[model samples]
Target: MRTTKHRLAVVTTALLAAVGVVAGPSSGATRPGDPAPPRPVTQNAVSDSFSDTYADPSVIRGKDGWWYTYATSDPLVSGGTPGLMHMARTKDWSSFEYLGTVFSDATRPTWATRTSGLWAPDVRKIGDRYVMYFTVTDSTQHPQGDDSAIGAATAPTPAGPWTATDGPVVPPRAAPGGGWWWTFDPSGFTDVDGQRYLYYGSYFGGIWVTKVADDGLTAVGEPVRVAVDNRYEGAYVVRRDGWYVLMASAANCCAGPSTGYSVFAGRSRSPMGPFVDAEGTSLDTSAVGGTIALTQNGNRFVGVGHHAVVTDSTGADFVVYHGIDRHDPWLAEPFGINRRPMLADRLDWVDGFPRARAGAGPSDTPQPGPTLGSSLGITPEDPAAGGFTGMRVGPRDRLGGATGLVRGTASTRRAAPAGDVHVRLDVRGDKPLRVTLGRAPGVTVTVDPRGRTLGMSTSGAGRPLRDSTALPRTSGWQTLTVRATDGQVRASLSEDDLHDPYAEVTLERDRLRVGSAPVRLSSGGTVVDNVVVTPAAQDARELAPVPQAGALITGEEFDDASTPALTWVRENPQARVEDGQLRWPVEGTDLTGGGNQAGLLLHDAPDDGDWIAQTKVHLDLGSDEIRNYQQAGLVAHATDDDFARLGTVAIWNTRQTEFGREVAAAPDGRTSYGGALVGTAAPTMWLRLAHHRTAEGEHLYRAGTSRDGRTWTWGATWALGAGTEPRIGLYSHGGASPAAVASFDHLRFYRTRWPSDPGAG
Candidate 1:
C-alpha cells in the first residue's frame, strides 16, 4: 500500500524579495495574473468570513445555545497573517461569523516561540471549565528541534479570555530512530463510564489513546496505539449504539488541486480500540482497511477530511469538516495557499456504520443547518434490521453463511419502504439475481454471476440502461446494494463491505418515478438473506464549474533561436534548445536528499498572483527494472534545500509522478526530503505546478500531471518558505543507465482562474 505523507510547515522565511514582472495581454484580453473577483456564498459552502482557511475543524454546542467551531492556525483571508488559533460560532450551523483567534500574541503560551505554530485545537467542556488541547509546533524546552507537544488552555466559556498551562499536557515522544514522533491532532472523548481519554498523533506515529486524569490536564497511563501509522490521522471518536467509532483522515492534505484527503472509519466496543471496519479488517493491519465515511464526490469540494461529528438538539448527527474548493483552490490571491472551507452535512447510520448523507459524500449545494442546543439522545434504528416477508427460511446461519437459501428458480420477496430507498442483501447464486424498485415495471438491476456483469433496466427501455462488466465473481456470498433516489438509480456489488464496492453502476434516467413503488427482489437458485431496505437521503446539489487553465503569460517554445543567455540561467550549459525541443541526456547526478549535482535550466517565475508552470517531457524509464530513481520534469527551485520538484520518475517496478519537497528540518537546519505521489506517469507526460502563496508568504505549489495535455489529474501540494522566490526550472537526473535522453517540447506559464458557474460560459 502507498503510505500517506505528513505535512511539516517550513520555518524559514523567503530569502529574496519578489520582483514583479508584467506580460502584455494577447488580443486585448484580461491580463493573465489578475486576481479574480470575490464570489458570493451561494449553494455549497457553509462558512462566511472564515470560509477559505478553516482547516482541521472541530465543532461543539455551547451554553449560549449557539454552535461553536475551532480550526488550525491560518490567515482567514489573502495577505492576512496567521493567528494562534482560529474560532467561530453560529446560531444555525449553516452560516457562521468569525469570532477571532483564541489567543493574542500577549496571551499565547510563553513557551511557544516566534516560529511555533498552534495547530489542531480540540476543545471540550471538561468539569466546570472548557479546556482546549492544541499541538504546539515548537516549545522553549526543546527549542532546537521540531518537538511538538500537546498544550492545554482553560476558559470559562467557549469564547473566553483563556488561561494556559505552564508546561505541556502531553509532551512529545522521542522517536526510536531520531527526531520525534509527530504528536498532533488531539481529540477528547469521555467513555460512558466517565473515563476521559485523549487521542492524538499523525502519520509519523499512529493515532493513540491515553487515559486522562480527572483534571484533564495530564495523562494517567501509557498511550496505546489505536490506528496504525502511515494510514490514518486526525482521530475523532464517538460512542454510538454500544460501539466506539474511530474516524480518521487519510491521504495527503493540502495538495492544492490534487488533494485526495478523505475520512474513513472503524469501530470497536471500547474507546481503546482494536478497531475494525465493516469488513472485520483491523485498522492497525498492513492492509489498512477503513470504511468510507466521507470522500470527494467530484464536486467543488476535495481534500475533505479531519472532521468532527456533532449531534444537534434534534438528535440528528452531522459531520463538520474542512474541504478545499477545487476551482478556487488557493487561499491567497492568484495562488499560494490552499483555500480550505468548513462544511457540514447530516450524518446517517446505515448498517451499523455512519455515512455522510447516506454515502452521498460532501454536498456542493445548500443543506439544512443543525439545530441549536445539545442532542436529546435520539438513536437511529440500524438499517440492516428491516422487515422482510414471503421468504422461506431454513436453519439460520448468521456467521459467514446463508441466512435464507432460495430453493426455486425465481423467488420474489417484498420489502418495506418506498421513497429514496436503499436495498442491500447478501446473495450467492450460479445464475443471476434481479433487484427491482417501484412497481411491476420499476427499474430492475440484474447481477449476473456467470457473466460477471451488473446491469440496469428501466420501465420503457428496450435494452439495459447501463451495464458494468467489472463485477467480481467469487464463490462466497457477495453483498449487493441498489439505491434509487432523485430520478437516478445506482447499484453496486461488494464483498460484504459496502464502503468499497467492487463493481458499481449509475443507471440512466427513465420515466419511472422513484419513491412511488415498493422494493422487490427475484433470484434463481440464489441464497438471499440479511435483506435491508431503508430510506436513502436525497443529497443531489449544484456543483461548481471545473477549473480551467487561463491565458498564457509566457512560454518557451525551445526553437533554435531560444538561447540560454537572455532569459534562461544555464546551470551546466550542456544542453541546447533545437528543433523546437530542449534535449538533454540523463545524468548520473541528482538534486535529492541534500545532493545538488544535477544540471538545471532555470527561468524567472512570475511573482504576482496564482500561476501555473508546465513542461512536456518524454523520458522513458523502462519498467520492471531497478531504475532506482530516474526523473525529468519541472522544478520550483528556491534553493537545493528548499524546493518543490514534480517529475515523471521510475522507482523500482512502478512508474509514477512524484512531487517531492526538500526543506530545512527544524531544530537544526539539516535538509530533509519527503514526497507525495500524484497521478500515474506515461513516457510522454505533461507536468504542471500550480503556484500560490499564503497570506504569511508561504509558497504552495500543487502538482498536476497529464498523459494527454488536455486532461489532467492534480494531487498533493508541497510548500517552500514564506518569503522564498522560487524559479521555475527543468532538469534530468537520478541514474545514467541505458543512456536514455529526455526531450522537452516546451515550457509554458499560465495565469490561474477561479472557475465561474458552468452556465455562465
Candidate 2:
C-alpha cells in the first residue's frame, strides 16, 4: 500500500508542555544539508497515463504496494472504472490502472455544496480503517462566491467501500467578499505519538491547525490560527529534523492557462505561532508567507498548484501536482476549458527550504523515468504525421492498452496519384498494397508481396516518370524509410541517386496528396500499435547547476547614512536613517501577528547561507520614561515564527527592572516564549548571533553578548529550526510606549564559525 507523507512524517518533540506528548528517536536520517549523493531519480513529470486529464491528485501509497492517487478529477473513461471519488493507481506512478469512484456524489452532506462536489480530499489510515477529510464546495465559484465545508468519511481500505458522515467536521463560516476565506480545504496530520490533528482553511481566514480526535472525526480543542498569505489553500503539514513545516499553494488555482498557482512555506519548532517568511516578517490572518517551492515553468506549462508530497523508500520527497497542458492547454468544445495533467518532480532543499526539481523544473524536456518501474506511459504516436498524409492513427500503446487501427482513402489517377500516400506500417495486408504520392503534381509507389521488383511511377506537373523494375522484396517485414529531401523518391534502399534513364522527373513543391479513394480493411487488418512525429526543434534542454556560491561577508559601519545608503529594507517608510545611525521611531508596532512582539526597526542579512550577524545597540532616551519590554538588540531571525533575540536592555514587564542580554525564540504556532534568560543592567551592549553546522550535519544557533565589545559571554545554544537558510540581522521593539525610537551602530556580518572552527586570520 502507498504510505502517506504527512502521516509517515514523525515530528516529535522530547516533551510537550501542554499535553506531555513524548517524542521517540530514530537513525540513518541524514541532515537536509548533507552533501550526499541522491537516491537516483530517472526523470520528472512521470504521470502521463490516462487518455483524460487528472488534477489535484491526493497521492498516498497503500500497504498493498500500489500507489493510489485519489484526485479531484473526472472519472476514468474505461470499462473497468470504479464510483464517486475518481481513483487511479499503479505499482509505480507510470502505468496507472483506473478504479471507479469510491463513493456516490448523491451522498453529499446537508452542509455540503450541492452539484459542486468535493474540492480537496486527504485520506489516511487510522487503526484498521481509512479516514478521509474532504472539502465540499462548488469549484465553479471557488475563492470567489463559493461556500464550502471540511467533512469526513471512513472506508475499510484505500480502495474504499466508504461511509460518509452525517455532517461537516469544520462547517463553513460566513464568507465576505474580499475578506478572509474561512472555509474548506482540510488536511489530516499524525504526530509521532499517533496524535491526529486536522489543518484546514482557505484564503479568507488563513490556514488553521487544530487537534483532532484519534478517529479523525472530531476536533479536540480550539483551532489555532497558524499561517496566512496570498490566496492560500491546500494546507499540507510535514515534520523534518524536529521542525513542523507548513506548506500551502498561492491562488488563482483554476484559471485555465492563465493560472498562477505556486507553493509558499513557513515553519516553527512547534506546529503552531508566528509563522514568518524569509525576510523576518510574520504571517497572520492577512499577510503572505515566505519562499516558493514550485511555480510556472514557461510557456510550455501553467497552473502548477494544489499539490501533495510522497516519500519513497529512500526518504526523498517527490511532489505530485497538476498543471495545464501547454500543448492543448485549453480543451476544445464539449471537453470543458482546461486539461490539467498530473505531474511529479523531486523536491530539493536549498539553504533551508524546498525547491522543486532542483528549481529548474516544470520542464518540457524528455525527462528520464522515476526508475522505480519499467513502464513509461508517455508514448509516441503510430504512423507518424510525416509518414503519410490523410491517414488517421492513434497514439502508441505498446503495452497492449489499445487496439491498433488505421484508415485512409485513394483517388483514381493516371499520373502521380494523390489522396493516400504511403503508410510505413509493419502490417502487410493479405493482398498487394498500392501507394500514390499524389495526382497532377504527385508521385506513386506500389509493392506486391509475391513480386520481386517494386513498381514506381509519377504523373505530375513535372516530367512524367514511370518504372516497373523487379526489385528484391525482403522477408518478415519491410522497414521503409523515405524522405522527400530534394526531388527524387529517395527510399531507404540505396545511397546512390534515384535516377533512371527511362523514368526522369523532378518535384519543385508539394500540395496535399496521398489518399485518393476510400479503402477498407479486408478482415480487421493489424497495424503498428504506436506511431510518432518528430516535431520541429525545441529549446527543451536541461539546465546545469551552479557549482559553488560566492561567500558573503557584507557589513555596514554606519559612518555616513547618505553615502552607503543603508541596505536594510523598511516595512514602514517612517523608519529612517538619522545622524549617521539607523533609527526606528516606533509609534506602536508589533513584531508578529499573534501580538507577542512589539517594535519596528528590522533589517535583512546578506544571504540565506550560514552567517553571524552582530551589531552595537544604542538607546538615547535622554532620561525620558521607558516602557516595559522596551528593548533593542542584535537579532538573527530565520523566520518571524522562529528566531533568536539578544537585547542590551529589556525592561521586565513583571519585575520592572531593565535586564541586559535578553534572549528568546518566537514559536511559530505556540503561545509560549522560548530561550534561556541571562540577567544584567546596561544602557549599551554588544550582541552577536552565530550559526554553524554540527558534526552529524545539522545546524546550531547561539546568542552571545559583550560589555566592552571585547569581553563576550555566549548564551545557551538552540538547535530546533528545520530550515537552515537564515536571515540574520538586528531588531528593536516598543512595548507599552508606542513612541520609542531604537538605534544601532556598526552592524556587521561574517561567515558563520562553529565551536570547532579555527580562528580567522
Candidate 3:
C-alpha cells in the first residue's frame, strides 16, 4: 500500500507538471508567480461596491449579453425565511444593478423550515431553462448538525419567479460510520465531454460528485468523493481550458465579521476522487484544506468562500460570494447579527489553475466614477455633509474646549467645483482653535485663528504645507482656501499666503475632505458651528502617489526620490532580473542593517481595503528555533484603530505559518480576540491580502504561499468590518533580532472584483 501510494503521488505530480502547474505548498504543488491577468474592459462593465451583500453567489451569462448574479440575502433580516436568494445583472464586472430576491415564500420546505437559512445556491443554464440548485436545512438549530437536503428551482431568466420542486433533489443520509448526518451545498457543472454532474456535501462528509440526470433535477448515480477529504463544505465547479476545476469552502463561516472561511481548489481528470494539490497531496476530505485560493486585504474584509462561478458575456469566468462590511461596526458583535453582502470578482486561469484578484473593500483604490455628483445641501443625517449633534457644547461655544462628536451619516460624498475652491463655515467662538480639513489618503490642513497662518499634515510622503495669508473672518462666518490641480493640491489661507516667498505649499490633485465627526471645542467648553464647504480649481500637476505607494519598490523599473523611507533600494549587484521578475541570488550575508533591507517598508499608517499592495519575498535561512511569527507577508488597511496583516510565517520546524489575519478595533492597537487563520504551514511563500464588501459585512482573506512559485499552502482568514477601506504593504517581524533578510520583489497593485466567489473543480 505504501509503495502504491508513492507511485500514485509521482504520477499525479508528473501529470500536473505537464500541464505547467504544481500543487500549492501545503498541497505539494509548485509555487506560482504569474500575476493575475488584466480584465478585458467592456461596455457597461460594473465593479462591486461596498454596499453589495452577495453570498454564495452564482453567476451566469445569458445569450442576451447580460450577466446575472444570484446570492443569499442578509442572514440577519431574512428571519426564518429560507435565506432568500437575491439577484443582480451586469454587462461587465465594473457595475451591477440589483434585481431582487430570487427565492422567498410564505411557506417553507418540509426537511428544512423557514428558520434554517437557505445556503449555497448554484445557477446554470440547462438547455433553454435556468436551473438553480441550493441547500436548505430543517431547523434553525446551532452547530448546523441537523439533516439538510439539496433543492432546485427553475426560472426563465436569472431574476426568477423561481419555482421550487415539491421535495429536495438530493436527500440527507447517514455517513458510512454514522459519524455525522450528511447534507448538501449542491454545485452543478457541464464538462467538455457534455457530461452533467452535481457536486454536494458539507462538513459531515467531503464533497461528493454524482452524475445528474438529463432532466437536471435528480441525481443519476451514487455519490463519489471528489475534491476534499476533510471538514470542507460549499462546493462549486467550473470548466476552463479543458480542465475540470473544483473549488470548495474550508473552515468556519457565518459568524459575522469574525468568521473564518476561505476558498480552496483542485483539479481532477474526472469529477471524482484523488484530486491532488500541486505537490500531489490528497485533499483531506474531513479537515480544512491547507491551500488558500483567494482572501481579503486591508480595505477588503470578511473571509470569502461558499461561492459560485459563472462566465460573463465575453466568456470570462467570475466568482460571486458574500463578505462582511469593514465600516459597519455593528457586525463586531459575536453571535448577534450577520450583515455580509454579496460581491463578485473576475477569475482567470493562470498556468491552468483558477485565480482571482482580491475583491474591492473599503480600503482599495476608489473605483473611477463621478465623484459624489452635485451636493444636495447639508442634512443632519449626511455623513460627509452634515451638522453636529450630541455635543456637550457646540463648535463655537467650546472654542478652546474639547467635546465628543460622531460623523452624522455613515457615508461620504465627493465635491465637484470649477477652480481652486474655498470652503467656509460659520463659527461662534472667541478663543484660539485650529480648523482642520480632512481628506482621503489621509490629507489634512489646519487653519489657526490668526487666519494668516496655515499648517498641513499628510499621511503619505509629501512635505508639509505652511504659509501665512490673510483670510476673511466675520463675527458669523470664516472662509478657508483649498487649492486643486489635475492631481496635486495646495492650501493657503489667502492669496497673500500663496505668495509668501517661503510658502511653497504643493499637494497632489484636487482637495477632498476626510469625513470626520463634528468638530469639538476644547475639553471643558461649549460651542456651536456649521461647516460650509466649496471647491475651485487651480493649475498643478497630478498628485504624486501617496507616501504609502512611493515608499515601496514595485517593479524593477520604478522608483521615486520624493517617496518616503518605508522602502529603500539596496546595493546588491547580485540582485538581478529574471524573466521580468527580480531575483536575489546572493547567500550568507547579514543585509539586515537599515537601508539594506530587501523588501519595501510601508509607513502609510494602516487604513482599510481602499488600497492594495503586493511584493515578492525570498528567504534563505531556515531555523527551527525561529519564532513562530518570523515571516514575510503583506500588511494592509492598517489604522491606529484597526488593521490586517496577511502572508507567510516560518513557524518551528513542524510547519510554515500562512497568515490570513486581522487586527480589529482595540483600545491600544490590539485585536479584541487576536488574529485567525484560513490555514497554515512552514515554507517559502507568496501571499496576497484583500478587503471586500458584502451584504453581511466587510471581509478579508489571505491566499497561501509557495517556493517554486507554482504551488501554495492555505493561510489565515479574518474579518475587519463593513463599508470601510484601508491601507496595505509588506511586513516581516518576530524572527531573529537581526532578522534573516527576506527579499521581496515584483510588486504591483490594481483594483479587484467585488463579491468574488471560488469556482468548483
Candidate 4:
C-alpha cells in the first residue's frame, strides 16, 4: 500500500479567466514581481516494503555520495533490542541497504542491560571516526523504575564496527517531579564556537542540555533545562544564520496503531535556550510554545516523531524520522516487531520558519545528487545496491514508437541520466527501437542512424523518417546518443558527425516502450550507454539572491523566499516594525478573539474595488479549542466577503474534523491545521493557503503547514468559488479564545496575470 502525507479533500475547479484570460494595466496584473505558484515540495514512500524498527533516524551524505542513516532498533531480538543500535544506507529514498545492528554483540555496559531498549540514536563524524549518541532504558528489569541513560559509541565508518563505552555518559538524574528520572533520547550538535552540546530528556522530565567533553564523550557540566513541561523528546539541533535551533518531538509517541507524535522546534542565541517563537515569546515551561514543525497524515502514515536534523553535502537541512505504516498497522506490534524504516524530507525556510513539503511522505525517488561512477547504473530494477542508480532500460523498456524490445529476456537495464535531467538515444540499427515515453507532449525519442538509410519512427506521432545514405555498422562497440530534451527528441551519433541528423519527433504520449520490430531479428542488438542528459538549470531570474546579514526584513529581495511579503504578514498579522525590532502588536479589537488577521493579499488593483486576486497564508491560531468560524483564512479570488470585507477567509479551526479524529486543541489554547503546535500561546508556525484558477478548474483552494516555516506540510487541497476578478486578505474574528491573541506578519500579495508581450533578447 502506498502512503502520502498530502491528501485531496475537495475537487477544485480552475478558472481560466483568473489565470490570464482577462487583464488590464491598472490591475496589479500578474507580472514578474508576483510570487510564483506553490509546487509539491515532497513526494512519498520511497522505500515502501520494510518494517525495520528504526527510530530517531539521522541521515548524512558520505564522501562516497551515499546517504548513511542510523537509527535505534526495537527492544526485542538480537540487535533490535533497546541497547543495540542499527544502521542502513541508501543512495535513493526508495531502496535501502541494511548494515545490521552496530552494537549488538558488544559488551553490555553497566548502565545498559540486555533488556534495555535503545532509543533515539544520533551519529556524526569527527576527524575520521563516526561518533554516535543514544539513549538506553533498562525497563524490562526495572519495570517500575526509570533507568534511562545517555550512552556513546565510536565507529570507523557510518556502517560501523562500533565500540560502546562501559557506562552511560549522562546518567539518570533525580526528577523534579520526584521519581527516578529517565535520561535518554540524546541529540548532539557542534555550535558555531566549536563546542559540542548534547540535548536530551524524556517524559519523566523536560528536555535538558549539557556540553560534551573535548573527547566528544561524557558531559562537562550539569544538564540545564532548555525545554520543559510538555512531553518533549527527540531533541535535535541545527544552526542557521547565527541562530541555534533545537527541535524536539512532543505528545504521546509509540502508540503503535494509534501513535500521535509530531515535531516542534525553538531557537536561541546559544545551544541552550530560552528558545522563542515567531512572536518573540519564550518557550514557557508551564505552557511551552514549540511550534508544530511537521505532522503525520493518516492516509500516508502516522507517528512522525523521534527525528534528527542533519545537513546534506549541499548544506540543505533535512529531518529524518520514523512513522507507523498506515497500510500495515500490525507492523507496530510486539514493541519492535514491525515499525517501518526511517524516512527523510528536505527542510525549507519560508519567511523565517522551517517548513516541510505539506502532504509529502518518504521520497519515492532518491534526490538527484552526485553519483559514484557513470558506468554503474542507478535504476528501480537494480538489485537493491546501497546507492541509487541514475536510470535503467530493460527488456520491458518502453519508448515512443517501440513497445517491448527485450521481452521475456532474463532481465535488462533501463537507462537514466546522472541527475534529474533529460536525454536522447541514437539508434544505428536498420529498424527503430520500440519504446514509449510519456503522454503526447510528453517524452520525445530521436533516432539518428548517421545517414538516410536508417529508418526512424515514433509511436505517439506514428511518423517515420528514413535516411537515404548508408551508415557504418557497429564493428566492436560504437556509442549512439538518443537525447530526450524537455519531451523533445533529438538524436546524435558521434561528436564529429553533427550534420544530416536522423528524424526529429515530438512525443504525444506519456509512457513509451522500446522493443523489436514486427519481424523477429537477433544480430541487431543496440549497444546503448552513456545516457547523457542535462537537467534544466534554475534560471537566475527564477532564484532570488540570498539576503545579506542584518537585512532586518526577510523576503524583502523576494528571490529564494516562497511566501510573498504580504502573505507573510497575513499569517502573522501582529508582526510589525517597532523601533527597529519586529514586534507583535497588542490587539485592541475583538475581531477574532483579539487575534490580529494580517495577511498577504493579491489584487488586480492597489485600490479595494474592481479587480481579481489571490494570496497565500501561514497561521498560528494559539489554541486548538478555539472554534471561532472567524479564526480562519480568507482568499478573495474574484469576490470579497462582506463580513471581513476580504476576498475569502481561509479560516483555521480547532474544530475542523479535517485535521484528524484527535482533538485539535493543544494543552494551551492554540489550534493547528496540519503540523503540531507546541504551546497554546504564541506558537511559532507557518501556513500556505491560496486561491487560484486553471483551464481545467475554477476557484482553487490550497492549504499547507510547516513548523520550521521553510518546508511545507501539505494539507487538504482543492478549489472553491469563482469570479473574473477577486481581492484577497487575511480574516480573523474577535471572539474565539476568550484570551485569544493571534498575531500575523510578513504579508505578501500578487495578481494572477501572465505577461502579454514577450521580452526582447
> lDDT of each structure?
0.67, 0.49, 0.46, 0.43
Per-model TM-score versus the true fold: 0.49, 0.44, 0.46, 0.47
Residue range with the least summed lDDT across 10 consecutive positions in model 1: 12-21
Name the runs in model 1 displaced over 4 angstroms.
1-43, 333-335, 373-761
lDDT of 3 by residue, 1-761 (tens): 00111122554344333322222212111112211113444211122442334566666644333567676545323233324766777654556676766665653344456566676677776644678888776533334456677888887665677887777787766567553455668877654333567888865666788888755788887778774433467877654333456777765565444455667677666656556544554564222233345555434455566776653211234556655554552233333445566555555455555555432212233222211111213331122234333333333122213222322222123332222233322223343434333323334454444453445545433233333333333232222334332234455322111011112234442222222212222212213233323332111122111112223323222242232434432344554445444444422321122222443345442333322344567654354343444556566543433555665554333233344333444323334322334343334555555334445655544443445555434344445555555445555444444346555654555344333332210
- Comparing 2 and 4 on TM-score, the stronger one: 4
Candidate 2 residues 516-622, lDDT tens each? 22112212333432221111111112222311212448777666645242334345555566777877654354454455444333455554445676777765433
Q: For each candidate, how many residue pairs have backbone atoms clashing (under 3 Å)?
A: 16, 53, 190, 167
Q: What lDDT tens digits, residue by residue, belong to model 4 across residues 137-205?
A: 763335555667788888666677788877677876666657666587887776433466788886566
On lDDT, the leading prediction is: 1
Order the candidates by lDDT, highest first — what do you get?
1, 2, 3, 4
Better of 1 and 2 by TM-score: 1
In model 1, state the lDDT of residue 729: 84
Q: Is candidate 1 or candidate 4 better by TM-score?
A: 1
- Evaluate model 1: give its TM-score: 0.49
Instruction: Write one digit per residue (lDDT tens) for candidate 1, span 1-761.
Output: 11112232222101000100011111211122221122223344677444567888887655344568899998877677887888898766555778889999888988777789999998876644678999998888774579888899998777866888888888878889788888899988765344678999987878999998866798988889987776678998886645789999876788665566877889999889999977676777543557767766445576788999875433356888888775666665534567788888777777777777666567776556554321111111111122333344533443323355444432223332333455656676677777766555556788888887888765442333455555533555566767654445677665422132446677544222243334555665566654545444333232223235788998888787555532443354656677899888888888866667777778888766888989999998775465757889999898877777888877654565677766664234555455555555678999898877665676667777777898675555555666778889898888888687899998888999533222111
Residue 80's C-alpha lDDT in candidate 3?
30
